[model samples]
Target chain A: MGQKLTPGDSRSNLYNPQLGMTLIVKTVTRWVKGFIFLFGVYIVLYGHLTPGGGFAGGVIIAGAFILLTLAFGKEAALERMSKTVASEFDSLGALMFLMLAWLGLYFGGPFFVNFIQRNLPGKRFHLFSAGNIPLCNIAIGIKVGTSLFMVFIILSVLRVVVKKGERRMVQMKRRGE
Target chain B: MVTLLTVLLFFMVVGAIIAVETKDLLSSIICVGAVGFGVSIAFLFLRAPDIAITQVVVEVLVLVILIRATISRDVTAISGDREFFSMTVSIALLLVIFIFGLEVFKSFPQFREPVFTTMSDASTNTYIQRGLIQTGAANLVTSIILDYRAYDTLGEATVLFTAILGALAILRAKARKRTTDSSEGNSDQ
Candidate 1:
């Protein structure tokens, strides 16, 4: 829906037809998105040591992306994160999480066992001391973030067309139709 | 503390009622979010920070989804007769549930101390004591979820994966159907 302007279109650079909000809003979003993303990463990494974990962090990460989309329009946002890339990351995250769980089985323990060394000398509450928990959190964070973002993107692309006074919701064309 | 909890609960209930009764979809969604925030605060006050964090994030995600879903649609109010009937049924159901809940609450013994203290098994005590030593994590909730009950966490993750996959599949199918229909129309034309 947002792919109307060609690269060589004169208006492409001058007026971003894909521009979502006012200049002030976009400027605020540009400043905030990075910090929000970093906070999400921090939450995921420190999940074992802190209250926030994969799901919460992932949602926050998705929130940052959503904010970007809201501020910069779908085309600009998709340049940063396309649907295919998001879908692939979602699958990759889920697979990585599953593989970690299977690793426990491969090591002759039950499924999802904390196989890595948990008790390292003088490493208590340290970031790297969680024995696969951090890895799991990262995987879950990626999966949840991408999935939620995908959901938002997909839903936003559904255009409600009122043709001849009959309302219909249709998936917007990849290129403007 | 009790007064604080009571106030939060009152607000939560009011928010929930507003969410259900509101004609505007966006306002209803926001009201629901307010209720969720109140619940999260209650969870924190009850010493369940992990749950509170998850609840708040989930609430926000849900709010975003709801907003996106309704953004382009016309805000059509429910018909008066249907709305009145639904409201009547809902209020009646709520009254019945409240009465039953009060009866149940009365049946339970009064707690002189904390509810966890009254328990005979002391599972909470055991988890608190052994959680750090066994799991090597400072957060008890993390230790329980990722270390002690890792399998349960795995199952929950799998459930989440399945749900997302299902949603993606459905949405993709709809898109495919639309494309094929348009293509057929073009060929006919």
Candidate 2:
């Protein structure tokens, strides 16, 4: 989905109309979004010991992407990154998580066995603790981010292409040379 | 019983109105989404999550395709007045279809219990005893889905493969791109 949507700002495409937005407002939005995204990351990382997991945290990060895209124009958002690349990253992330789970078998254990163990030298209630919860969260975050990024990118690209074609035709008609 | 159904019916109607009347293409798409969601909720209150999910996902795909198609239309090319009459007639036919659809609901039995929960129970119990002894997983859904029902997963994967193949077939182009607006034409060209 993301592969279909991401467009480059070449001679055929658009420029960022919202980059000139006020610094204070933009700064605040970015800061808030960044913090929320980071907190979501924390949620996924410690999922084994905590209530939040990969899915919850992934959605939070997606929300942050949405905020960043809205604050800047779609072109600026795409300028910083490609949707195709993000989708590939998402697929790779899921693959790694499953691969790690299966890798447990090679270590003389069952699939998805919680092999790595470290204690706070105490109980099972620390953020730095939890065996493989963090790993699961990372997978979820990637899946969610890619899905949402695809949805938004598809909508934005479709809109931009139509607008660009219209503008081009109008410009050609007006030149009358 | 009647009141709840009536309220849902009314909501769908209003949503349809808003979707038709809206000027901005985005607003109309949103209204279409809202109408689909409203119907999904009604399907839920009718006690079917699977149905709700199906409707919502399909509707999302449809609305996205429609919005893209509409945007690609040459907006400057206005049609004749007869097109409006044709639209009204088609819409009236749609309302008649809706009336018949509601009547068809009487044929299905009311939700006594979720069929899957009961069906899943027999499979789940077997897996529970076998999984502990065989697979070491306590979660019945996971055990059944991954280990016991590996064949089903294979089938599901095959289904996904078929879908991707179909998409690839449609997306593939042999001729040079003639600058058609579709993503397929763009990429192939």
Candidate 3:
């Protein structure tokens, strides 16, 4: 979402106001990111009755993280979180998704099969009543959020390290000792 | 159908402009991200969510690679390349693509077609129609990815794995060269 400030960045019109006033920036960005993220969640949750599903929701959730990165710098975005933690979250998401598929084996008759027993008393077309569809959405949300967070951290870190290395190489070449 | 495709083409043009004219490298990559999403939306409109998802995944990976490349690359506008002929060429290409799309849409059978019209009649009908029955999985796309086309899902996993590997190779290339240089320095000493 956001690019690292470069030597040429001074030429660009945008500024990193988030860095100076993070308290205000964080609040606003959180709302913006949260809205986008939740809307994706809603789409995935009700995908059975309408359009959208796990992958779409997952990407949208991840896009929210990209927004966070753009609004706040990488460190600020992960100030309370860490890379390994995000990776763990990603694994947990993948695991739970697998577990849901196995549930089909016990009740739905086979792997990846949806077995709706029609126990819901609510009328059709309502949220929370999409049988197993909402569950898939939840799984997708978790997997996407965590994995995307991990990707954000990794890419940001690489950018930082690469810039540092480039500076060092120049310094070494300058010193002819 | 023409309206849908026209809207999609509009998105493509905006995305191309963003990706090309944006001076900021990261934003440019993110512009590509925007293009990817738009392309997937177009795919969805075409009734191919499977391709859409796959396209999304691949494009995301491409964006990551682009971001990595931008760390060493610079973007500049091709001011000199902006000529009447080039503009004509681009517009002509876009018009051709639009015509081809419209032609394909025209070839599709009307909704009256019995077999292809209903979701239950499709090839993956076995897995897709399970949503109304017992499996409990609601999102047919999820069901397709995780169940019916599980093998394709595995292939997607492999694609991601390959992407991760490619990223590793790219990001580490400089470091590897640095390590080798340091080793050479040690021998020189």
Candidate 4:
């Protein structure tokens, strides 16, 4: 992430109020972001009933956040979900999925035994159906969504180290350096 | 359907070739994006809406990241020293890989036929045939991934975590550490 400031611009664009894209993009983002998020949630929740599962839904969810960041800059996006929080959620999702497997094992079955379906199978094609599949999907969705968003943020924001009266990033050495 | 798929794949290949030949990095990225969207549409035509949705979203995010990367950076390709030789070698390698891939696919079951149903075990067939009844899930794909073969999904999640860990390790290097030490990590705030 190279930060390009114009010739007369002193303050970095990161701190600028007009940091992001043009007015049309921002306004359209404001209108469409909620729908994108809702669509993502719908895909995640109905994953058992539909063609999409956790991975696709999670990517859609991350796209909503990425849209916000692209339209209104990183600040607005970070205000909604910060990098640290996203990282925490990422781990939490993976842990939740692992916990589901462990629970199945503890309940007198092998790992990931679909314990709910074994006991009381819900009605087919219903929202509360699919035993533990929906829960697993939700966990995967959260994990993937946060992980991808964090990757985008990490890649987009460059660390500018102030060193020796110079304001520039210390470029990491390439291979064979 | 086969003809449609062939046409789609042909366009995708052309887009890829244009992407490689284009000097402008932005247009090249967009052309690559076109190739990806073509694959997504092809996935839909193949009746894999799951994959198509994922492909489109992933493609959009990749384009976003790529454009962001090039926005403040150089947008033109700086011709390297060994371009022609590398291109020849890569094309040769791709042909070799394609032949090997065809061999691998020849050993697999035919398309649109569930391979598990052909096995000897009756109980396995029961699970495969009556998965909707057993799992109470409408979508067989979801049941197959999250119920029957959950360990695979778990492994995939772990792989994703490991990839993110590697990315963070490389991206957050000495520059971030020194800045955080000096600024008490309040720079983001």
Error of model 4, residue A13, in angstroms: 12
lDDT tens digits by residue: candidate 3, A46-100: 6655566666677777766666665566655564456667767666766676777
lDDT of 1 by residue, A113-175 (tens): 777743242367888776787888888899989988888887777543333222222322322
Worst 10 residues of 4 chain B by lDDT: B72-81
How well does candidate 3 score on lDDT at residue A49? 57
Q: Name the better of 1 and 2 by lDDT.
A: 1
In order of lDDT, best first, we have: 4, 1, 3, 2
Given candidate 3, what's the lDDT at residue A46? 65
Candidate lDDT (C-alpha), each: 0.77, 0.56, 0.62, 0.84
TM-score of each: 0.83, 0.50, 0.59, 0.82
- Among all windows of 10 consecutive residues in model 3 chain A, the one with the lowest summed lDDT is A11-20
Cα error, residue B159 of model 3, in Å, equals: 4.1
Q: Model 2: which residue pairs collide?
A: none
Backbone steric clashes in candidate 3, count: 11
RMSD to truth, every model: 6.2, 9.4, 9.1, 6.7
lDDT (tens digit, per residue) of candidate 2 on A102-159:
7667766667654443212223455443344345447655665555555555555544
TM-score, model 1 to reference: 0.83
CAPRI-style grade of the A/B interface in model 3: incorrect
Error of 2 at A139 (Å): 1.2
Query: Model 2: what is its DockQ?
Result: 0.10
- lDDT top scorer: 4
Write one digit per residue (lDDT tens) for candidate 2, span B9-32: 899999899877766677778788
